[model samples]
Target: MYWWSAVGDYYWSYYRDACERSLLYLDVLRRRGEDYREQSAKAAPHVLSFDFVVLVDGRMLPRPVNYGLLRIIPPPEVETDPGKRPFIVFDPRAGHGPGIGGMKHDSEIGVALGAGHPCYFVGFLPQPVAGQTIEDVCRAEAYFVRFVADRHREADGKPALIGNCQAGWQILMMAAMEPELAGPILVAGTPLSYWAGVRGIYPMRYLGGLLGGGWLTWLMGDIGNGIFDGAWLISNFESNNPANTLWKKPYNVYANVDTEAKRFLDFEKWWGNPILLDAGEMRFIVDELFIGNRLAAAKIATHDGERIDLRKVKSPIIVFCSFGDDITPPQQALDWILDLYEDVDAIVANGQTIIYSLHQNIGHLGIFVSARVATKEHAEFVFNIDLVDVMPSGLYEIILTRADGAEANPQLISGDYIAKLEPRTLDDIRALGGNDAADERRFETAARVSEINRELYRAFLQPWVKALVDPAMAEFLRQLHPNRVMFRVFSDSNPLMAPVAKAAETIRGDRHPVEAVNPFLALEKMASTSIVVNLEIFAKAREAVTEAIFLDVYGSPLLQAVVGVGSSQPRAARASRGDIDLEAAHAQALADMTRGGFIEAGMRALLYVLASGGADERQFNALEALRNAVPEAARPPLSKIREIIRRQAELLRADETKAVAAIAEILPEDSGRRAEILSAIYRVVSGDGEPDAGEMEKFREISRLFLGKASPAELHDRQEA
Candidate 1:
């Protein structure tokens, strides 16, 4: 009986091993069947470009849009004339493919085409075209813009360029290099100042430092036999959301596998086909951008030693980034404006127009890919690029909010698009990048440590590793990568479970789907949520420990002293185009200032109140009422208010010499009246903190030209005589 039991156990073990081998064999057959099916589908006439490319390039050669190796989808059957303003949509070459702009008809390109603008796409090949540097891509994109511009110049509006994500910075580089070739430039979710961010947030900027420097990129490129897989970058992005990466994303697809097949396939096709960057290119990005933070510092130099000054671009810049984007946070996107100029006035003074829009909560991918964002934000931006072009040269926040029915100045477009305006201040923008010196010092120290580690790694490990790697092995490894394997081996045909595939297809076709909003579905979602929560907890704990260790070692005051913080100030004032003459601006500014007499009078009134006693609400209300009821003639023009302030400053300048006599002259017959007048004048004159250079210059000139060499009392005495 004991011998019989032992034989049975052996038989069970053999049966299990045979079953696993059989399953593997069946998977290979099913994958071949799917490949055959895909090839058959490609040959079918119904599928456009065999479910590959949708747009046809109508150039002289009449090439396929897929010649660029990007899948381009054309708009619906709408007759858009080629004579209209052409729209060129450039997808940011981040870790993803090009279709984020036109994944659907409600995209940036689609919205432009819907508005009668002829649309074109600027995309890249899946593999780099041999020696294709970023400079070559910029040139190609510029040539594309030139083509569109020439096509639509007769229509009066220059072709508009919409750049998404990493494409935003690329477009700016193109625009800066060839300012005359393009029109409006819209940069969405691109970081110009790579190192700009506040503490407790935007910690992604610290990643290169914590992991060492660009040498890791070099190591990866070496392992890949001179090609750095973009999947690594995509993995870094996924690591930011561990719950989604580990469980939530896969579970959701599995739960709705029947309905999610097409969507999952389409997205996976793009996300899975990760591109490669050259070792040198990746090094430039990590060294010049990620660690050096040189772009905003005016320190990014070309191979020829020429500097790429962002201020040189003549076209208006529209910066669109969001708070929720960890990759390209609002700080990295907008702080470059602050870092490149002294103030909002300096931006205008440089003859450069920059407008930025900040969304409350949209992640990096959502900035250009999310359908809801495309409908609302991208729609408004397209409708108003012309308005934005005409806006006064200064920094502005582009706000998009719902308009009430009765609002008079609503700008309406096709189907539920309503947009309006609200002014924003520099203070509002400072919330993102306004970190103290100590925080910046910490990051600086991290950069130093990273440099040291990177050098050490290259000296010790790289030589031995490179000797063991080759191109064929790299390619094989890439194919075997988990992301690639999913596409290569999956779906319908297995001898062991051939029935399951047939069942799934039938279930998809004959779908008795429950309502998406069902209560039981919500319970299923709750169970999934628990799994996600636990994953998130583990990820957070890991991140916290990593950050703590990093900070403990590299965040010391001694390290900060050794590796200094980069200045967030502009190196020097950018040379202006002299479009706005300084004298003319001064006159205009004076004119605007003089028009606010009541504001001047209120300041005077404030001086009296503060000097006498702090005013109660009732007293303030009474003063406001009286101020509102004043006659129009009494209210000064901007010129008069400035003139009054000018004369008062002049009086103060003469205070050392003619203080008593001048005081006697402007003083009223009553001592109380004289005190009141002097106090009011002092408040207005000293509003911007004593006298500045321009104020002093203006005062000297005004005194010589207007009042001659006489005091107020002398002039009064002369009039009396």
Candidate 2:
């Protein structure tokens, strides 16, 4: 009787606790559903933790759009300098609301504000105006940038633009269109060379191919009465990882239902708020980007016939991606360099400073919103953005190592990490791996097939779909979409879920919490894990089958011949500009060799010491620290300083020894002025860690040039005088 009673008691306890947990889980989900409904009702709502004021409303532009530019109001504790370059963040409009860049205290906006730069955000409303085109959006963004630039005329450079995901490519386009107006640009979690990806990884690249070239995209637009719902795109993202969407995420909340509610609701507020786009806009994106893959090759032209070229953008570019991001892998994020330039030499010739940083592990959203990334990568970028602007044209990798006992100038380091820009070659980017020639041929054929299918749908099927869908029918269909329906059913709008809230409240009042080591809870987690594994297996298998079909169908010789995109067909390469003449560039640099003085000599000598490879924030930080050595008013304007640095670095690249010898000529004849300059140069040079053999040798030779004729002093006066 004792043994039987003990077994009965265990069963009773398990049954009672499970019921309570179920009620609480339903309560949490109901709260999430309600939060989603409330957020969806707002217009142009952002999750920005900081306050902001609207500056330019794109809806009011001549070619109106749903976009708007807002100036971020920094908190009282943060001081912004008007003379510093302003930072404008463009959040991705890919099926979600704006403010991902400033969604938290530690984010891209926070990084810029902490560095004393003013911040602006370009966000959009939930619905696009009728007949709004992509060109209208682009044109409006360009105007916003110009307005920001014009207002900050006292600043040293053009506004630095930060584009996240979908906005990254748009930023690149605007930068190319008006190269003179953009400053340093950082594109995070963005994929530009859409056709470029490794097999078995980032299967999202094959989505257009699987759908047979976006015929369904046009069909959806037609069925929606000429408007496309962003919910479809959101569904695509969720489907990419079935394990996460189907089991892991929901189960985590169910298991920790009490503690996880707030975080889940906060994220869903942004994710659940879907936007609407014009059908024509959706068709354009599908054709020019998803299927056609023409942006990197400069094959995409504006309505007025101006080709969109990536090479025309003159500002420095920093690409931050991750190996763990399944959506926008490093291969997709960095392949545009391979698509645009033949080699690193071509990159340097074009006078582009391209820097990329790779994280070992981070998801797509984490790249923009994770506090760890904000404190590390974003902080380093803001801290060294000016150095990037003045850096010579070349490819580089940004490396951040922890600041610890072995650091040479730990005192000079601003944060916990020491950041450095190590020079990289095109081979380094290629090492990441991507599609080969055979894969390109297959993709080309697929593009051709897409064009054929798109035309077929337009000529045959579209009219029927458009005719069948009236305004009321379209609205009903949109409301019934799976993504929207899930929220509606669990929200207060549903009477069935109403009793769940009352039961949850009663359970909380008489809470009987289970032990952490409950057998039922353990079994529940095991089942959840098994379900997640099975779902992932299913997703991968589906991807594999889709990929196989795509390759076989498009790779056939007869199909290729019929499509006129066969192996014999020429692939699109970078458009030839032949604009960067290095010899002429060297000659131009030589003309300015005799034009500068003490400050120029110090910078040139520092560049030579750094010529062997590259320097980090050490030298820049050293200069800032020694700024008090001279009067603030006496410092040369930022523009003049950039010009001097560019010329000096160019001369050194063309003729190193000649450039070093000419440093003496640029220096003043006063022995005291020469010593003052030499002292300043050495102080900056020693800022970095102990020099290697080659660097030390160059430093010594440059020191010889500086002390050619010297006496004593402190920080020298500005050279422009």
Candidate 3:
């Protein structure tokens, strides 16, 4: 009888817990549905944490667009100075509404505000403007950037541009078109080379080929009444990880309904709010950028017949990508360098400074959305923007080192950091792409096939689809889309879920969570794991088969010939006419070596020493302090300082020994300034625990060239004492 009673109690508890969980899950879904409805009511819904005023509305432009420039008003707690450079952030319009870049306190806007910069955001409406095209959008964005620059004439320099995901490419287009208007630009999770990826790792690049190219996209747009719903794009992202989309996400909410509801609901608000793209815009994106992979090759031409060449972008570019971002893998992010330039020297010759940082394990959205990433990587990028601007033209890898002994926490840690801008090369980028020419050829074939399929569909099928579709039917179909259907079904309006709210409240009042050691809990865990494993297995199998078919079909020489793969050797490199004459430029720089005063010579030598790759935060601080110590009348502007540094770096690159000797010859043999420079160098190098042999050698060389015969160690020790 005791054993029977025990079994009864177990069953009762299990039934009660299950009912409670079910009610809570329904409540969560109800909240998500409400958020979705509320978001849908707004014309331009976004998740920005700060209030903003419209600076320039693209709706007012001659060729109107949905975009607008917003001046972000910081909260009272955050102070801003007009003297600081303004920041303009452009959020991606890929499938989702704007403001993911500024959705949280630790975000792109937050970091800029924290750094005391006046911030601006470029956001768009959910519906495209009537007759809007990608070219119109690009023009509107360029106008906004120009307005920002004109508004900040008193600031130290031009406004810094931060582009997230799709916006990254958009910003690049603007910068390439009007290079002089852009300042330092940061592009996070942006893919420039769509056809570049490693086999068995990046499967999304193969989807277009396997699906018979861009015809399906054209068909979908035609059926949607010339408006392509972004839900399809969002669904593609979800399909990339079925376990997360189909089971783990839902199960996570069900298992921890108490704590995870708010977070889940917030994310779902953005995920559920799908935007619409014009049919023309969608077709161009799918064909030219995705299927054709023409952007990296500079085959895309604007409406005005101007080619969009990335090398024409005069601003310093910072590319932030992650290894775990399957959507925009490192190859796609970095391989464009290989496509555009022959080597690092070519990049330097073009006078473009490109710096890239690769995160080890953040997903695509996390690159822009994760609070931890915003606080750390975003913060570092913000802090080092000035450094990047002053850096000489070349390829660099931005390395961040945590403060000594800080615990490894994913959340933001407010502290000092040591950043190293180490020089890299085209080979570094090629290594990421695995340097496979055959794969590129296959992608080229896919592009040709896509063009043919797109034309064929437009001629044979698109007209019929357009004729059958009307606005009413399109709206009905959109509402019933799988992405939207689930939300409606679980909503409170559904009579089936009517009892959930009251039952959830009762459960909340009398909660009884099962212990971790419970046999039933263990069984639940096993079931969840099994479901995830099975879904992952299925996803992998599908991807493998898709990749195989893509390769087999597109890799055939017959298909290649039919698609004109051997035609005219890919597009000519769209070399910018503004490309510098490196030899003449180097000669001019060498001549300028004798032009600056004691302060300029000292600063140049100090920069040369730091370039050896061992300088730390302490050193940078000391150098800044030294620069500040100069009288305002004598001190150079930040722009002038950057130019001086650039000239010196170019001279050093041309002839290091002569450049170092010239520094010693140009400066007056006044020991005071020399001692001050040496002291600052020593402080900078010692900040990273202590200078190593390489650093010591660089320092010694600087001392011999600038300060006659004094050992760097002696000078350092003397200064310390």
lDDT string for model 1 (1-721, tens) is: 6976766665554444334333433433344446533532441111111113424231212222211322233445656666455667787666555566776666787677666666777665444544445655566666667766665666535777888877888788878778767667899999887767765556677677777667787788778877777777777888888898788766755565544555655555456556666665666677767886766766765566766668767677888888889789888888777666666656655556677878889988788877788888888777665445444355666656564544322222223444433345566678655545555556566666667767786899888778988989888876665655554445453344556455445444554444455444566678898998899788777767666665665666665555654444223233333354656654554443323322433342232223221112222222323333558557443234333433332222223233222323332355444333333332333332343455344333323322333333343343234
Task: Count clashing residue pairs per candidate.
Answer: 6, 0, 1
lDDT of 2 by residue, 605-677 (tens): 8788777557677877777666546787896765677777776777777777777788888788787676656
Compared to the true structure, candidate 2 yields what TM-score?
0.95
RMSD of 1: 14.3
Q: What TM-score against the true fold does each predicted structure earn?
A: 0.68, 0.95, 0.93
Which is superior by lDDT, 1 or 3?
A: 3
lDDT of each: 0.58, 0.83, 0.82
lDDT over C-alpha atoms for residue 117 of model 3: 90
Give the per-residue lDDT digits (tens) of candidate 3, residues 1-721. 6987876776677666767787888899987877787888897899888899988889999999999999999998999989888999999999998888888888999999999999999999999986788888888999998898899888877889999999999899889888888789999999998987888877999999888899999988878888999999999999999999999999999988888998898888888889999888998899989998788888889987998989989899999999999999999998888778888788877778999999999999999999999889899888766667777788889888776654332122234556777888777877775436567778888888888888899899888888899999988888988978887777776898788778788889998876566666677889999999999999999889888988888878888888777634453354453546877877887787677777667666766666662233445545555567789777666677677766667777777777777777677777877777677667655655466676677788888776666786688686777
* Candidate 2 runs further than 4 Å off: 1-10, 568-571, 709-721
Candidate 3 clashes between residue pairs 3 or more apart in a chain or in different chains: 619-684
What are the RMSD figures for all models against the true structure? 14.3, 3.0, 3.2
lDDT of 3 at 110: 96
Model 2 C-alpha lDDT versus the unseen true structure: 0.83
Clashes of 2: 0
